[model samples]
Target: MAEIRIENLHRRFGDFVAVRDSNLTIRNGDFFVLLGPSGCGKTTTLRMIAGLEIPTSGRILLDGEDVTFLRASHRDIAFVFQLFALYPHMNVGQNLAFPLKSQGTPRAEVKARVAEVARLLRIEHLLHSPVGRLAGGDRQRVALGRAIIRRPKAFLMDEPLGTLDAEFRDLMREELRQLHERIGATTVYVTHDQIEAMSMADQIAVMDKGVILQAGPPNEVYRRPATMFVAGFIGSPAMNFLPVTGPVAAGAQTIAVNGAHVTMPKLHEPLNHDRGVLGARPEHMELADAASFRGRVFGVEYLGARQLVTVDTSVGRVKVRAANTGKAKAGDTVGIDFRSEALVLFDGRTERALASDLMNGAPVEGRRAAHG
Candidate 1:
């Protein structure tokens, strides 16, 4: 078990910054995930901690010691690359025991340890199977076993499941989560796949353009995003950013959007028309009576449990999710209604949520459970 901390970390190459000024603390034995799209610097930051890339500035602390300059071989850490780095010639058992054997451990002890890990990974049946012949999922398990066998202080995995097929990926996700629970090792996982991060992480840090936008529990980050980019990036269909410019109806505490009257969300202050954006989640919207906003259904996507219905409203195209059985068809005229309570206000200029306490029932006339 180990605690990893990065303080004032920055990594730049020539004129471009790979990782900007960032600070984070990964607690002991937590399944922490660094999530972001490509070029967001998650991998660069991970490399710095693994001693693969030196931070141009700031410090890297492991457990309590500063090891920013430590070489990769000196860090008591196991790094599982995205490629599932394994020797084609080595069988599953040999690959798993390589670490222990390299240290000149006794043959019996190494064999015992390898057996233990192989059983733990459920790869014991394939012990003598050459890695080249193993399935993708098995190969991944072998790769993980090789890392876990080291019993390193922390594990840094860089998109280890990115290459697996959908079915195998889902299976490995559950297996990996359970594996972490059984071992209770400190882990930092990096991936651009929101599903992977959302499902597995005890805590998730959403990154973009080298900056950590929001860091919190998966549910918290989704429910109360600090910036517009986060709200738009973390969700599946993403949050809807509808453009609306109209007079504030103080008498009704509502705003007219595209000729439809809808209750305005509580903001820290009244709207100053500073390019305001009304953000709503697909799940938070529904088809209602004709009194609400009206639109023409553009399409309906049946996504197993629910259907995402797209409507070309006066403001723009909006996506509303309903139970898969809900009757919605293309070219149908429908009433689009906001949940009222689920609406959020964002200042376009800053691309940040307006300060409000709307999530709580009290509704401070201004701004905060979770989708996942």
Candidate 2:
């Protein structure tokens, strides 16, 4: 097991900075995931920890030992790339045993380790088959087996399931989490897919634009985002934001929104600025008899269990997730109700989040924007 710590880590490529001012800690036997969009520096951060990419500044410590300048081979960590980089000519057994053999372990021990990992991954029956002909899922298992056979101090994975079909990827997510629990190794997984990170990680660090925005348990990040970037980035279908278009001040009970008179929410303190964005998740809005607003149904998506209905309101377009009762359809008029308990407010000018300490009926600063 390994306790990985990164302090003020940074990496720059000339005029462009890939990762900056990053500080994070991965405890021993923890399933930590680095999540972000492409070019957001998630992968770059992982490469640095694996000793594949040297940081421009900062330090990396493992179990109280500073190994900031160590080479990849000397780090005693296993890295699993997204694309399987196994030897095509070698069969499953050779591929799995290669790492152990490279260390010149006894022949008997290599065989024993290969067999143990193969059984653990449920790929023992394919040990003699050529890796070139294996299915994608099987290939992934072999890749994982190779890493596991070595028993490295820590495991670094960069979207190991990126190439698999959606169905298999889902299955592998559970398998990977189970494997982490069984082996109890320090793991750092990197992926752009939020579902993958949310499902498999014990802790998730959401990254963007070369910064660690928020790092916490998946539920905390989802429920309490620190900024507009995080609030909009972490949720499915994204977050619905309505901007107050007019000038705002510190205290206002009601404001004009989308050409409609809307009541403001009670915040813990008066808002610093009136002009800001109001946020609501689709799942929070519901159809009500005593609706606060009305809009024309623009689109209705049937998601089997529920229907995501988009409405064109005077203020702007709003989406609501309702039961699949099939009563609402496109072109229909519906009374929209905002769940006061589920609303969030953000700063309009900066677009930063204000929902961490507050998530409810928030005051608007100006007229509602057409698009938020």
Index of the highest-lDDT prediction: 1
* lDDT, candidate 2, 1-372, per-residue tens: 789999999999999999998989888999999999999999999999999999999999987788889998988899999999899999999999999999999999999999899889999899999998999989999999988998889999999999999989988999999988889999999999999988888888888999888787787667656567877888787777786645544344454556544454544333465576777788877876457578889999999989999989876888899999998978988887665555566777666554222333322221011001
TM for candidate 2 is 0.89
Query: Once superposed on the true structure, which residue ranges of model 1 sit more than 4 Å away at CA?
Result: 246-253, 269-271, 324-326, 361-372
What TM-score should be assigned to candidate 1?
0.92
Task: State in Å the error of residue 165, model 1.
Answer: 1.4
| Candidate 2: segments with Cα more than 4 A from true spot | 245-270, 355-372
lDDT string for model 1 (1-372, tens) is 889999989999999999998889889999999999999999999999999999999999999889999999899999998898998998999999999988899999999999999889998899999999989999999999999998999999999999999999999999999999999999999999999999999999888999987787898678767779889988989998887574332333466676677775455555566387788899988887575688899999999999999999887899999878768999999998887767777767778776554556332212221111
Using TM-score as the measure, the top candidate is 1
Instruction: List the global CA lDDT of all models.
Output: 0.85, 0.81
In the predicted model 2, the residue pairs found to clash are 228-353, 245-367, 246-366, 246-367, 258-315, 265-361, 274-365, 276-348
Q: What is the C-alpha RMSD of each candidate to the true structure, in Å?
A: 3.5, 5.2
Residue 149, model 1: lDDT of 93
